[model samples]
Target: MDPRLLELLVCPVTRHPLSYDKAAQELVSPKARLAYPIRDGLPIMLESEARPLDAED
Candidate 1:
């Protein structure tokens, strides 16, 4: 993803800043404990589409 876009994107639920997880190909919202998927080079920011983070995460 573009750095400009990444800088502008935030967690939809918590409104917290997102950090890109290159290995997982996700935009992680640590505060929200959610990882939004990046599909086909586009971010799926919907909460319903996010994966919940476990304790290990």
Candidate 2:
């Protein structure tokens, strides 16, 4: 994802800044522990589409 776009993207639920998880290919909301998928090079920012983070992670 582009840095410019990442700067503008926020958590769809928490409205907090999201961190780019390159290895996971997802945009992670640290505060929310939600990982939104990046599909076909586009981010799917919807809450329903995001996956919950595992406790151990």
Candidate 3:
């Protein structure tokens, strides 16, 4: 992911800032407890496509 783009992107559900997880290729929203996937270098920011976080996450 581009550093500039990551800085601009926010969680659609909580409108909170997202953190990049390079290994997982996800943009994680701690406030929303969701992980938005990055596919083919593009972020899929939709709420429906996000994965819910577990206690460990």
Candidate 4:
């Protein structure tokens, strides 16, 4: 993933900063409790596409 693009990207639902989880290939939105998937070098930012985060996550 491009660092420049990561800097500009935010959580679509919360409009909050996203933390990249390289191991999981996801962009985590702590505020929204969602993890947006990153596939084929592209981020799937749609809320419907996001996975709900567990309390332990």
Candidate 5:
């Protein structure tokens, strides 16, 4: 994903800033405890498409 795009992206749930996990290809919303998937370089920002964080996460 483009760095400029990432900087503009935010968590749909919490409306907070997200951190990019390059290795995981995910946009992590710490406040929302959700991980939005980035597939084919496109972010799936929908809350319905998000994966809940595990206890260890």
Candidate 6:
């Protein structure tokens, strides 16, 4: 992901900043407890499409 794009991206639900988890290749929103997937270098930030946080994460 581009650094400029990362800076401009936010959680679709809460409009809060996201943390890029490079290891998981995801953008995590702690406030919303959701994980938006990064597929093929594109961020899927839709709340409806986001995955809920699992304890193991």
Question: In model 3, what lDDT does residue 57 have?
Answer: 94
Candidate 6 colliding pairs: none
lDDT of 2 by residue, 4-55 (tens): 9999999989999999999989999989999999999999999999999999
Give the Cα error of residue 28 in candidate 5, in Å: 0.3
Pick by lDDT: which candidate is best?
A: 1
Better of 3 and 5 by lDDT: 3
Q: Candidate 1: TM-score?
A: 0.96
List candidate 1 segments past 4 Å from native: none
How would you encode candidate 5's per-residue C-alpha lDDT over 1-57 as one tens digit per residue?
A: 888998899898888999998999999998999999999989999999999999888
lDDT of 4 by residue, 1-57 (tens): 888899999999889989999999999999999999999999999999999999999
Which 10 consecutive positions of candidate 5 have the poorest summed lDDT?
A: 6-15
Q: Cα lDDT of all candidates, in order? A: 0.96, 0.94, 0.95, 0.95, 0.93, 0.90
Q: What lDDT is obtained when candidate 4 is compared to the true structure?
A: 0.95
In candidate 5, which residue pairs get closer than 3 Å at backbone N, Cα or C atoms, i.e. clash? none
lDDT of 3 by residue, 11-47 (tens): 9998889999999999999999999999999999999
lDDT-better candidate, 4 vs 6? 4
The segments of candidate 3 whose C-alpha lies over 4 angstroms from its true place after superposition are: none
TM-score of each: 0.96, 0.93, 0.96, 0.95, 0.93, 0.87
- Checking candidate 1 for backbone clashes, the offending pairs are none
Task: List, in order, the clash count of every candidate structure.
Answer: 0, 0, 0, 0, 0, 0
The 10-residue segment of model 3 with minimum total lDDT is 7-16
| Consecutive 10-residue window with the lowest summed lDDT within model 6 | 48-57
Compared with the true structure, model 2 gives a TM-score of 0.93
Residue pairs with backbone atoms closer than 3 Å in model 2 (clashes): none
